[model samples]
Target: MMLFCDISLAARIERAETRLIADSSDASRARRGDTLGFALPYAGGVASFAEPDSPLNKVAGLGFEGVPSPADVDRVERAYAACGAPIQVELSTLADPAVGDLLTGRGYRLVSFENVLGRTLDGFQGEPPPPGVQVRRSGDEEFGPWVDLVVDAFGHADNQGVPSHEDFPRAVVENAIRDMAATGAWRLLALRDGAFAGGASMRVTDGIAQLTGAATAPEHRRRGVQSALLSARLAAAASAGCDLAVVTTQPGSKSQQNAHRQGFSLLYTRAVLVRTA
Candidate 1:
């Protein structure tokens, strides 16, 4: 029946979402600096903390294998509290609505919604980069430049009167790069005329590759730089034996359009819940 098929599809997506979050948490833990990062596992979920001012300091990997109870939620809250940060959780509307109900009952507020998109790589193909554009794996010398390019491309502004990059220290960025490398993730850079034009990063786990932080310099917009990066990353993921590629973007945004054009389908939407300290 159609209902049965829909339920099966939803179940598959839920499983994928859980794996994505857990792998992402592990990736974050691998990137933790001495005093600025931490990841704790509790029943039915995981809590992660990055730089106090960085956007990545929050909890994910929740309700993938089982629905989280109020007690589980409290455990995660305590874990983050020990790190001196407010509790923030990312939940998929499709995975387990019960988890969202539990958080809402506990006074967490929905903060944002992100569209999770994915594509199968059974017959994957990639377009070549634009003329004079070179896509390559980033090295140690490229880490500083990589951070600069990503910050500019994303238009990340200073927060609480601190410089954007200062709030997100270079050390954290370096650790992330190193962590990705250690876990078989690819750190890619796009160069045009020997100048950095864009950057993208991806990590493959259990046959799925997550493409994240794809950004192109403002001056390089509309030049196919992002398209080139996407193509290259997809090709790389396929080569690594990944059967699926996933990305999350603001609903109906330009990024969503790009993903659609590249054959990715909108899988589901997830909202972030926050509880301020």
Candidate 2:
């Protein structure tokens, strides 16, 4: 299938992602009782502060509205300033070109880039898992174990190709997983012969299925755990009436490789620009 990363499509995905970030901020506030953990609308997108040192402390969907005015950038910086965190602006390459100029003029420097991959889910029913692998929805009864396994897997996963730009601690990752589920993400678990092997998550909005993340335990590598989890999430999202499924991965990462094998194509790249406060 053919997919184009036109401005309109980029805007739609950006908007959805921005909204999810904003909702996650709200969830963080409720969970931690921190008043600064909130979201503010700016330049037709959102500037969210999830907590100190969080990657979510950034502005999303910036140029979709237009190149943000100097005042708009100042306002976002001030918001992040109050919380003592850097202002991360994830600008889509498909956004107005002028947006990059404005941000650089204000001292935001290129930090890293992440690729968004997408696939059409129209009439797509996912294939069954490989032998001895099982994928199923995670619920309250399994939340603790599921989270533990996810955290452990992420802590021990092998790194190759472009090194990761961000390294999150276990405590922060735990908080993030809980916040994601609180803000509408559906968690799934993969089992190898009835033993927990991996975990993943998905969030859908306006027919777009966001494959939030997935990770397999070090011992479970090459057992089809990640593929099973991805297929199960895709099937679930398609059945939920979603027409598209998207996942964001670091450049040259194994995650991107897996996504490519599953028919996901590059949709766009988000240029990460940061202004340290």
Q: Write the per-residue lDDT of candidate 2 for residues 50-125, one digit (tens) a residue.
A: 8777766778888888777778778778778887888888899998889899889889999899999999988887
lDDT of 1 by residue, 1-277 (tens): 0012243454555454444444545666554534445556644455666555445566665655577756766777776777677777777766566777777888899777777788888768788788989999988687778867876676642122212112356555545444445555578999988899998888776677878668888777778888888889999899889877888787666777778888888776777788887
Model 2: worst 10 consecutive residues (lDDT sum)? 157-166
> What RMSD, rounded to one decimal, does every model reach?
5.1, 1.2
Query: Using Cα atoms with residue i matched to residue i, what is each candidate's TM-score against the true structure?
Result: 0.81, 0.97
| Clash count for each candidate, listed in order shown | 0, 0
Q: Which candidate is the best by lDDT?
A: 2
lDDT of each: 0.69, 0.87
Off by over 4 Å in 1: 1-37, 156-183
